[model samples]
Target: MACSIMVTAKQFFGDPITCITDEIPQKVMDTYCWIQSTFTLPHQLDRVAGEEVAHDGVGSYVDGQHEKKYHKYYQWVVFMLFFQAMCFYVPHYLWKIWESNRVRNLVSDLNNPILEDEKKTKQLKSLTMYLKDNFRFHKWYAARFFICEMLNFVNVVVQIWLVDRFLDYEFSNYGTEVLSFTEMDSEYRTDPMTRIFPKVTKCIFHKYGASGSIQTFDSLCILPLNIINEKIYIILWFWYMFLAVVTGFSIIYRCILCSSPQFRLQTLRMRNRIVDFHILESVFNHGDIGDWFLFLLLARNIDQLTYRQLIEQLDVSITKKTDRESFTISMDNERESKDEVGMLKIEKVDDFKKF
Candidate 1:
């Protein structure tokens, strides 16, 4: 009963200390405390960062008037780069995973009428013939499959290099404890503070517009600087793995989402048309009939021939729907008397947004 009350108090007021009352169950409180301690990153990170102002001190390599800059500039640059890589890129891949899941649901809900469109199939054949006469499928596949795939691979390699560089530099300044001993020795032995006494007052730069001046020349050493103790390697390993998995999942899931049953049927019809017209075999000499069929299948809006050309070449009447709000199209036979006319009512929903 006390454990429940303590948990309730913490849940209501947002303080874990409430869970520590003597009335509470010891086991429950212990578990809660352990969880809280394990999951949170160190709050000491920022405090240690402020104290280890390597560039602020007088004896530091870059702090002298002749040096013209802070020694910490390089460290800051590296830290910022790594922060961006971890914060921005990791979330980016996670967001892609979420997007893929959403798109997959959207595709599953879309509607298609290919099952009822015999006239549409006939009209598709005519459209295919016209495409054969006009466009070469081989050229498109050469660029899309060969060129784009190679570029994507190169981009992945470049991303890995940049991320590795950022990580390496960001963590280097952590192991600088030996500098503190050197600074202490230089301050006492090298200079006589008695005779040439400039003002002995220590003024600290308050970068945040506060009145407190920083002890710029203070020799500070960062404690527990080892990233291994922090389990950063495990975190980074999981982060990179998640990124790769999400990227691959996004590509597959996006394809599935955009190609709803209706979209898949449309693709199949396009492929069948390409095959019937002999465009797949003639234009793309490198690809087999099946390969060209798939290429045209996945490609959107691939009607390389006009309605007039389709009619003249294949004796079919293909008509597009007039509604701009919908992506629907239709095809019919002008001469053949059939009660069932082919009417396609395609809608460009959210699933197809990426494509």
Candidate 2:
């Protein structure tokens, strides 16, 4: 947000660019530079100013299409920064809304379990029952947070690509080119920052003359703001790339924990070894992915003593539920077997009667 405010002020409140000339009006030439943009003659950068080149990177660009680089990102940078800030905010907003004080409400007074004996017991039991009732239904809750991590990675990658296109593909290698500064000769060591954000560039303005003919005026423009731009973007380029790598690793870690039951069990055991091992195994076997995510979250928020008690209660309830289901299935199979035997007996009796 601060970045957005700063850029908006720089772009709208005043001009960061100034073009000097006597052939055309100052106001018209400044406006032309803002709209039409300025370009650098890269080959002219090597020539001395005032002798061969009028200004650094300010000379002929005709028939040198490959050598000329246009500065088109000046006006759009503010909007781009503003959009990036918005993209980051979206995940935060969604997490807050979806979470909606769940952890707070669940933890409630348990956060400080130093309550009176009866109050502690009551609060602990209430949390246990709530978890027991909703064991396999937290898939969305867990997925929402995981998705937030993924969105962070996606946003960084997309913003990088977008900025690359915004800066005429120069941004894709901006960091790499900056790193190779040591290899270049001292006599011709033009900073990659300068190439991307040049100090001086050329813009041409056209108008009608008194003789009913078009008049052309070439303006040499100075960008005092590119100094700040170069500094900001170089830092941002490295930071965003690092963030992408870290987030990608985070996603991989989550996948490993979720997909590998042994890994999840080990993590749980490390969190609270005092809990009965068989109870943990039973709870794990009876639940889905969402249930496992919620258990991990619970382990982090509550004390080990309270968590152990809660898991014990859940194990009791889930074990009974699973047993009832298994029993019902076995009875159903038995009933089906009896029906098949009865049909076979009936068929045999009919065949004997016909004989």
Compute each candidate's TM-score over C-alphas: 0.29, 0.84
Name the best candidate (by TM-score): 2
Error of 1 at 183 (Å): 37
Reference-based lDDT, each prediction: 0.34, 0.82
Which residue pairs collide, candidate 1? Answer: 204-213, 204-214, 205-214
Once fitted onto the true fold, the runs of candidate 2 whose alpha carbons sit more than 4 angstroms away are 11-14, 48-55, 60-67, 113-117, 323-355
Give the per-residue lDDT digits (tens) of candidate 2, residues 1-355: 5665765676554567889999887888888898889988878777767898787777776753647678989877778778888987888898899889888888777658565778777887888788778877888898899888788888888888988888888888899889987788866776788778987888878888999899988888988777777877888899888988998898899899768988888788888899999889888877777788778878888889888988898888778887898999999999999999999999999999999
Model 1 lDDT per residue over 128-236, tens place: 5444433333344333433333434344445555544544433222223223434665424322111111111111221222466542222222211111212343344
